[model samples]
Target chain A: MATQDKSSIFADIDEGEVDQEDENVDRWRRNLRLWRETLAKQWRMLTDDLMVRLAMITIAFFMIVAVFAPFIAPRGPLTRQYEGDAGIIIADWVEPSFLSSESEYLLGTTAEGFDIFSQLVYGSRAALLVGLVAAVFTAGIGTLVGLTAGYYGGKIDDTLMRIVDFLYGMPLLPTVIILVALMGPSLWNILFAIIVLQWRSTARVIRSQALSLRERPFVKAAQVAGASDWHIISRHLAPNVLPLSFLYGAFAIAWAILAEAGVSFIGLGDPNTVSWGTMLQSSRAYSALDFGAWWWFIPPGICIGLVVISGFLIGRGYEEITNPELR
Target chain B: MSDTGAPDVSDENPLLRVEGLQKHFQINEGLISSLLRATMGKEADYVHAVDGVSFELERGETLGLAGESGCGKTTTGMSLVKLHEPTDGRIEFRGMDLTESDDEELDEFRQNAQMIFQDPFESLNPRMTVYDTLAEPLRIHDIENETARIRRALEFAELQPPDHYFDQYPHELSGGQRQRVAIARALVLDPDFIVADEPVSMLDVSLRAGVLSLMERMTEEFNLSVVYISHDLSLLRHMCDRLAIMYMGEIVEKGATEDIIENPQHPYTRSLINAVPVPDPDVGRERVELAGEVGDAIDVPSGCRFHGRCSEYIGDICETDSPSLEQKAEFDDDREVSCHLYDSCGKQS
Candidate 1:
């Protein structure tokens, strides 16, 4: 079944050449199958718990609402139901249409004659946007720093870890508030603030995971195989420590959303944006709590609570899978 | 020290040659602690893991490095593959000095020399499939025909119909099967030399013979010279062509497998050979109990490293001078021992 060609001891004598096209197609199909199975398993684990399932559902609902805000929201977020003296609908202090037939606003109107329904629907976009985008950047930066620090260790670990320690020394909310104030209360500035602090937790956790991972015999085996430092970090250590990065990534989303909401509650949110934080700021200015207008403040607050809770639940699901002992 | 048992010194080149190889690990690697030591004016300490070790291997020959745990046998094996860069001395593989080798040469060295570690459970990455594990070195060295090569290597290692295991993870295989996969990974590149540090020590007794026979067959088939590091003297006698017994990071005694096992020269070697269970109650072997426990590698005994535990403590010189490994016994010209017991003890008198 074999030829005497010393060069091709592994080669099949009967098979003249390996068709690169066939090999690529075969590998592609295999990888696709593997991906499908892995995704199915992860989905099962994530949805196994009733709490986690509800959390997933909440995230899904927010995602849908955010994507379809234009159609789902009854009016433009900035549209005032009553403009100047036209005021045909008596939009000022309008109660929810469901609560009182006299009001036309679905989730009621703010004291400023704005439809709180439209603002609430449109606000989901900002929360999801800042949370997901900031989390991605945070996870990427944290994973890079952690993998490099832990794999190369010694001096590099000391430098990066000390930087993380210094960052940890800063209080999260105050630092974010000062940053947002300096950058002038924009959504992007808020996201930047959240990302700056949020990456540290991921970096610290991933660095510990990477520290233990690099010491595993597999890493030394890779070294013995003559793998470069970069190759070992990327191919071997990164994949093993990836679950920790992702776990922190899920938590970063929650942290970003909460940080943004906290800043917005304290009136540092962007004046021009339609985020839940801005909604809360606008409602709070009119003393909605004093006026018994729970609709004005409660929906955005509930939305923030649901998103953060679900983010944590989703992160816990990932942790259970990555660390079975946590299950 | 005289070199560990290699045939014919005049020969131009053997597969691998190691001389005065040493590897020391600093006790305090942390910046703050080391700085604290510097401030205190205390010299930094190190664990002399592999100290002044020398050995050579011919093509297709197996040299078993035998010693108790913590005797630096494993460290010497690691140093041989350049896994632990020598703190000093030379490791020349086919006349190429590995320690000073540039990236290209180091890369070449990596391809030509490989290692099979002690634990199969720990060595294979838990996440990687068998295919990925075997394909790692090939991908690193840019070797192509991965599937075919992996299949052949697996089959050669006797994981018959190797495709059966291509998709499985390490946990899926039995201990013996995992060791075979480890061996397959090492041999995938067709390396000229390999260091197997107790490859089967972690396997069950039933599975050990199969892996060992497979390795013995692979050595012949691939013409690969191997340095096996293990404390099991009987296993060494069964598997090795020649044997070197290390004590406190130095080669204490070395010779052909039969010479070292049949007539061990040094007190340490004798104690090691005596400890092996004979498996026969009818023929009771003499037991020789030595002195204290193995000394700390950090503060190795000044004179002969094994002098504390050596029962044949002949003279005062045993505690004062380090004896060079030489052909100390006349009857067996090949065997070497490092002990003042064989010396005239002129200074003590």
Candidate 2:
């Protein structure tokens, strides 16, 4: 019996060593294996997942165009090209002529003689930047506030929730526009305005979720184990609330981008930067409909619509994963 | 407040001494109710979940708190560990007044005292792996060698080859395994005391005996004091050294488990013992069924709380005043009963 036990223990030790070796095998190969597994899981999840597929395709297209805008656009956004029709030098407000052999202006030209296609391509970078950055900051602040409020619910919760309610009651768009106007319409200033107005909704949603989770027995067990409040909130509460926050983040991005576009439409946009909103704003100056330059207005509008729709699709896709009951 | 005629405290004081423990929870009033109460100059209602319960536990003792649903047995167990702070009471652990301890002292107390919940599945964090759950208490107490502690705890819980279960999530393990993991988590800290609230009630019938025997072995091996709360008296008789029968929010009878079972004094305890089903078909047994639903905790009876459904009612005194716990002469072992039949408070006296 003693010999049998010794042999069994040796076998177990050997098995442990084999497992350790398996874990430490070439770092790059391990990373590659991890990446392969993650991709396979994502692929399986995306099978028949129309919303995720559509969102991925839309965002990927926008990202590619934004990254390689200079190569993709027929001409520079600020470049001037003078092509005379019957020696008249018709340079500005050029109409869409797909069959014209003079130049490759597939979409046309803006009122300032800038290629409209180039403006549309470059516009994606600003829109995506504001949307992604604002949403991330908003979600970060909101999650912190929500976790603190929900976990230590009493005077702290009441104070924080009242502040949230106050922010929620404010007329969001006008307040943001006023703030942006005062700040001189810089990109960072607009991003800050979006975050301030947007975080209340995220805080409210995450607080409700955290409130329900606070009473679970695991939390009570942690309390009994003498775990500090900070440990409980960060280690236990945050991970459970993160998936829902991702869903909230996706929606917040769409709203932020739209808010930026609205600000630009009202002529409060940053003058130095070119965005999809600015392109649309410049079209209004040319009396686009009367001038028959449909190309100038249509491309930016379609881009904004597709991007916002993709945001909703991504948000819903995450919602389905986080809340399986919804699926 | 220094002394309220409780049992004398001496150098030989038990590991835990609870005296006049009372926990009343106020029923939260809505806006309209509060306004009306303010206008009427009336106080809000309260549910006396644990009202004036007291007991003493020696080192390495296993005390079973047995009662039916809503009898406050669970509440008593919880109050002992300060899970539910007592509205009025004194809990002395190791001769120090736990009720007056500061935050740091209470944290130290939490390290010494731990609790196991009724539902194993709900007690564990579904997202945490078995190793993580077991390591948490050790981490909290700053115990060294966490890996060894976790492995030993897994072995104590009979989850052999701890590595097989180290990374398994709660959802992947069977109900019995999850419950074992919960047990291992409590055992990992090597606490001096544990309050297991219906630990085996949620498990399958086949798994219960194994878990209970494991708990029994652990208690002996670790010299751990334990309060086992359950509605099942048969289980108590099997495991407890002493048994306290709870009715409403008070202990009606308490004594050596065998003495209490062989000769029950209080009517409530008698009925509780009778309610336990007998396995033998040929053996005849008497059944005592009390009438009426459990009365509201907010409006407890003025006199003996059990008199409304008690089988042995002496007279008007049983309806006017309650009886205090006193020694009875019928049993050879020391047994205390709180019934007018066993006391001199009845009208016949």
The candidate that achieves the highest DockQ relative to the unseen native structure: 1
For model 1, the docking class works out as acceptable
Q: Give DockQ for candidates 1 onward, in order.
A: 0.42, 0.24
What lDDT score is found at residue B163 in candidate 2? 77
Mark the 10 consecutive residues where model 2 chain B has the least summed lDDT. B1-10
Per-residue CA lDDT of candidate 2, range A1-327, in tens?
Answer: 011212221233334433343332243563466457645864567545976897889988998998898899877776666545645434366665684566567777876777877888889988899889987988898998998999888789889999999998888789889999898888788889989988998899889878988888788778888888988898688977987787789898899889898888778888788888888887786677777778888899998999988888888887887788888
Misplaced by over 4 Å in model 2 are: A1-50, A67-91, A96-99, A181-184, B1-11, B329-332, B344-349
Cα deviation at B179, candidate 1, in Å, is 1.3
Error of 2 at B92 (Å): 1.8
lDDT per residue, candidate 2, B1-349, as tens digits?
1232223442368879999899999898776998999899998899989999888998789999998899898888878878778999899986769989887667667876888888888888876678778777777776555665677679878999987887677888887888888888887776768899999999999999898898898788777889999998899898899999998899999999998998887988888888888899987778789778777799999789988888888899889988887675554566778877764432210
Model 2 achieves a DockQ score of: 0.24
After the best TM-score superposition of candidate 1, give how far the Cα of residue A149 lies from its true spot, in angstroms. 0.4
Which pairs of residues collide in candidate 1?
none
